[model samples]
Target: MGLFALLNRLFHHGPAWLTFLVMGLAAAGLALCSFNLLFLFQANYHLLFTYGAMAAFDGGLLQFIELTAWGYLAIACYVVAEGCLEGLLTRIRRAQL
Candidate 1:
């Protein structure tokens, strides 16, 4: 099975504390991702306001690319966190029925 399926199965059969721990970790991940995203935006504020002029400076292209990659990483983290939380919630709902 895929990673999500495996995780779902594990959470489904695991103790209640295990699910809660995973949920808490996921929530913390989401919060950290949000902060990283915000930091990326704030750090690039000058480049944004300059209308791409700052990108003409030395090493600016490399910095921009690095920032883009970091932004993607943060987004991926957010997606993973959301997925984990969703999976846990789905398991909980199914168990309640």
Candidate 2:
């Protein structure tokens, strides 16, 4: 897809660690929002990041951290696969020349 290509180009030159950092931040932000909404129905309230971090750290809030890890692993695998495929295609084209 065009969007995929665009994103790949944008990130291709950066350190992979940056991508993971951004992903974690994004997940934390979403968790914070989710926690705030979920807390509305309960009598208890906690600090925003505290509740959000619980989603990633605590065993009771939710397993969002595990889910995020899985998602990141999947994306890493895809990038490796794509890179291998591109390399193969380049080799094949060179052979045909």
TM agreement with the true structure for every prediction:
0.55, 0.40
> Which ranges of candidate 2 are over 4 A from the true structure?
1-62
Clash pairs of candidate 2? none
Q: Report the number of the highest-lDDT candidate.
A: 1
Report every candidate's CA lDDT: 0.64, 0.49
Note each model's CA RMSD in angstroms: 3.7, 12.4
| Candidate 2 lDDT score at position 18 | 55
lDDT tens digits, residue span 17-63, model 2: 55555445545554544444434424223432456665435543444
The CA lDDT at 42 in model 1 is 59
At residue 92, give the lDDT of candidate 1: 75
Over all chains combined, what TM-score does candidate 2 have? 0.40
Task: Give lDDT: candidate 2, residue 14.
Answer: 39
